[model samples]
Target chain A: MDEPIQNKKVDTPQDNSDVITMRHIAKSFGDNAILKDINMDLHKGENLVILGKSGTGKSVTIKLIVNLLEYDKGELKVFGDEVKDLSEQELKKLRTRVGFLFQSAALYDSMTVRENLEFPLKRILKIKDEKELEDRIKEVLDSVGLPDAIDKMPSELSGGMRKRIGLARTIILKPEIMLYDEPTTGLDPITSKEISELIMSMQEKFKISSIIITHDIACAKITANRMMVMDKGEFVAEGTFEELENSSDDFIKSFFKL
Target chain B: MANAPAASYKGILEEAGNQVLFMFRFFRNIFRFDFEWEEFIRQCYMIGYKSFPLVGITGFIIGFVITLQSEPTMKAFGAESFIPKMVAISLIREICPVVIALICAGKISSGIGAELGSMQVSEQIDAMEVSGANPVQYLVVTRILACIIMIPLLTLMADALGFAGSYLGVNLSNHVSPQLFFSKAFSSVEFGDLLPAFFKTIFFGFAIGFIGCYKGYNSNRGTESVGIAANSAVVNASLWIIVIDGIAVQLTNALGY
Candidate 1:
């Protein structure tokens, strides 16, 4: 089988500018291999969408970038530092630079929207001034277009509103990299499109690199600078949305079929 | 067939080992210098303050019923004056702490277990970790420490209410004033009886918090695990309370307390 087009980029000269680099990465839980010798890169200031079926290790790959899950073999580097070699403090510092939006949004349900947003700002950034805390929270909530939701508990918010709040909470610290695990999974198409637009806008506003894992082709078309299609724990095809759409491979064409 | 029992034994040992490691991590996080005082105070309010009414009621019932039932037996033995002493020693040294701890195992342990389990199921704990916040420090240590501080205080309240209920019981049949009843209750009670029982309730508190936090924190990745964690926390904490009670009794006897 021919290599995916994205594998070609993995061979390019190592650049300090690339926010994340994974080479020959493999991971397994017991005998079940979840990722097998996959190579990938996230260049600075680009949205790299990974499209895969459920359980194809899409979530696991993004999890590895932040050291949420360890790779069993090969190398993963974030900001040129090998992920597995980082000390606990260094791992934590790396995590602060990267933001992850989980599939379920994963907001602290016990906390109101304002407290949820305040969590990272207080714990990681250690912002002590009440005035500063209030301002930052208001700013982030306003940017997400849910300024009225500051006092509402997570259970009180609609699904789309919760996702937006989750995004706001992650971006509050102004991270350099964002790993979105299905940012628009369960929402209606209109909300999904809006979230995808928000992802693009956030990229433009923050100038941060992103890796969006999704099966939503419409989302891939709207947000991906480049896209990789995963199959059976490996990258089977990779190109721009238009390039992959025009590819001769039937499996690649299946993703683009309306 | 022989392998089955061996496997079961190995599984239990492995679980015990994991619990020890979890406890060690809890201790390590306690000394990590950035104790979450705000969250600790909040947990104390939730775990300690909110649980007072139930404990108070149970204590009152235990004291009243024990006094009432023991009356006939005491009158038969021609030792009716010993009723207050008997209720006092029994409630303070044995019944109040054990019963109150068991009640907490059902209420606090199960509550913490389910709450944390649901948090785990929803991936909030993961979100905290990825955000570089210590979830153990924020969630586990605060809850356990709150249980430790609050359970003893709750037991103390139970002890007082138990005595009050006993006074009411004593008044129902006879005409002892509050002063006479309390003085009679304390006359036979010594520091030896108080110290060991009071000391054992502390262990009971620790066991309840530790088991609850451990079960909830390590719950598997499913909604079903939430219920399982809660059930397991209550059962294990209840069992630990009994085991600790037995050990305390043996130690007290050996030391001539």
Candidate 2:
């Protein structure tokens, strides 16, 4: 218990090309196929959304990118580094640059919002200066439009507010790539729209590439620069919001329908 | 119906393997880069401090009832005067520590399991992993280390209460001053009797924390798994407590306890 921790210092340089690339990505659970031979790419400063029905592996795709879920077969690269090939130290460095927002917001329920936001800061960035840490917390909270909710608990917030706080926690470290799983699921239409707009605002403000997996067309339409509609384990369509909306494919039309 | 046992057998084997791996990972993480001091203290408060009342009550009842029930038999043999000595030896050497551990397996282990399971199910564990903060160090190491520190402390407290309860039980039928009773109690108890038992509680602590963390941290992603993790944590931790007690007793005996 008295042993001091040996800090393993790590740093990965920023790149200008594709932030994430996947080819023939596949994952399965038992005998069921979740993602099958999927290929995708997210270039720098792009917002890519994968729209799919429930149980269609939308969340699985994003989880795979972060190495939270291992792909049965595929090559997944984030920031041009093969995800499967990265060492533990490299993976940790990669994760610090690519923030993931869980579907449930996944706030540390025990910690107040301030502590929750401070978690990644203290543990990951190892930020020691109190003034800089507080300033970062304030800035992220303000950007998410919940500056007053800093001292509040996640349990005290509504669904939308929790999502905003979740995003704030994710972005406080200023990651170059963000992965959002169902950013606006289970919210009212108005709140959903607000979250979609917030995602776009974060993209524009931080200039971070993001992969948002959602079922809500409103979310995709509002936030996605390009969208991929998934069916079964494969993407059935890929285009801009308007292109996918105007496409005659019945599968794509089903998602676009009100 | 035929496949049920086979499936269950496979499930048990899988769980055992996972638990072993979890234990290894826990040890590996503990000696790694950083320790979560804040979280560890918080877990100490949650696991150790919060568990006192229940473990205390359980230990007391155990000591009192064991003394009370064995009275007739001891008196039949005209050995009534040995009650305090007998109770003290049994309580300090085995009964109090084991019973308190089982009680903790129920209280502390289950709570750890449910908490970690819910965290796993809700993706908080994954979120922590992706955030570049070690969840194993933060969550598992903290909880386990808290138990390692706390279970002995709890066992020591429970042993004291058990002696007190036995004193109260002893006085119910016959008048004996606390001084006389403790003097008789301490007459038969040596450092040998206390040391092995006290030592075993550390393993009891490890068993409870490790099993609970294993069940919960490896739990599948479902709400049902939370309940499953908590329930399995208690069952497995209690089992491990007995197993560890057996091993500790054998080792102590080899050392001439």
Please report, as a residue range, the 10-residue window in candidate 1 chain B with the lowest summed lDDT: B26-35
- The estimated TM-scores of all candidates read 0.96, 0.94
Error of 1 at A127 (Å): 0.7
lDDT (Cα, tens digit) per residue for candidate 2, span A175-254: 99999999888999999999999999999999999999998988888899999888899988899999989999888888
Model 2 lDDT, full chain set = 0.89
Best DockQ among the predictions, by candidate number: 2
Error of 2 at B252 (Å): 2.4
> Which regions in candidate 1 have their CA more than 4 angstroms from the true location?
A1-13
**Per-prediction interface RMSD in Å:** 0.7, 0.5
RMSD, each candidate, Å? Answer: 4.1, 4.9
Q: How well does candidate 1 reproduce the true complex, by DockQ?
A: 0.80
lDDT of each: 0.92, 0.89
